[model samples]
Target: PSTSLLVDSMVKKGLFDRKENPRDRRSLCIRLSEEGESRFQLLYNGMKKRLDSLFGILSDQDQEDFCRIVDTLYTHVYTK
Candidate 1:
């Protein structure tokens, strides 16, 4: 899907607020609304709980290794 379409959909759903950028008239500043923040927090908490439960089946060493692998992936993606 196009980025503009996604942004327009989100704005229509009241999940995001789109404002004209003061410094650049052709640009827009998109931010999450309060409702979006609340929804995101709920989603994050649910995912965290599910991950915790899943990871609980692993041994201490395995869990540590899993975390290390995730950290490495995150760093690789963000630093590229």
Candidate 2:
């Protein structure tokens, strides 16, 4: 699907606010609405809880190693 379609859908659902950018009237500034922020927090908390539960079984050193590996992968993927 096109990005415009996705943005339109979100706006229709009241999850996003789309407005003309102040600095560039030709462009738009899209941001999450209050409802979107609330939903995002709920989802983030749920995922964090699940991850914490799953990782709780790991030893401290194993957890550290996992974090290090994740950071390395994130850096490699994002820096490229």
Candidate 3:
């Protein structure tokens, strides 16, 4: 029911693998399964295509202005 339990179950089911981090070799690394990678890639591509179509009306300058506006809003809100 909890996240740790869910992660444990997923590990048992092999949807992810726990490996020793090569850089540290002492800490654990949660690596996605082959199936997980395939699913993730498919979902990512689908979302990206949808967003691209939605924003396609914007010119490059418009996109840049939107990003700056969003960043300013985020900074103002978060710093408040």
lDDT of 3: 0.87
Q: Kindly give the stretch of ten consecutive residues in candidate 1 with the minimal lDDT sum.
A: 1-10
Best by TM-score: 2
Error of 1 at 64 (Å): 1.6
Q: Which model is ahead, 1 or 2, in terms of lDDT?
A: 2
Instruction: Please report how far candidate 1 places residue 25 from its true position, in Å.
Output: 0.7
Candidate 3 residue-wise lDDT at 2: 100
- Candidates' TM-scores? 0.80, 0.84, 0.69
lDDT per residue for candidate 1 within 1-80, as digits (tens), equals: 59999999999999999999999999999999998899999999999999999989999999999989999999999998
**Which residue pairs come into collision in candidate 3?**
none
Off by over 4 Å in 1: 69-80
- Candidate 2's displacement at residue 6, Å, is 0.6
Note the Cα lDDT for every prediction shown: 0.96, 0.97, 0.87
- On TM-score, the stronger of 2 and 3 is 2
lDDT of 2 at 20: 91
lDDT of 2 by residue, 1-80 (tens): 59999999999999999999989989999999999999999999999999999999999999999999999999999998
On residues 14-71, what C-alpha lDDT tens digit does candidate 3 reach at each position? 7788887889976778888887787789999999999999889999999999999999
Q: Give the residue spans of candidate 2 off by over 4 A.
A: 72-80
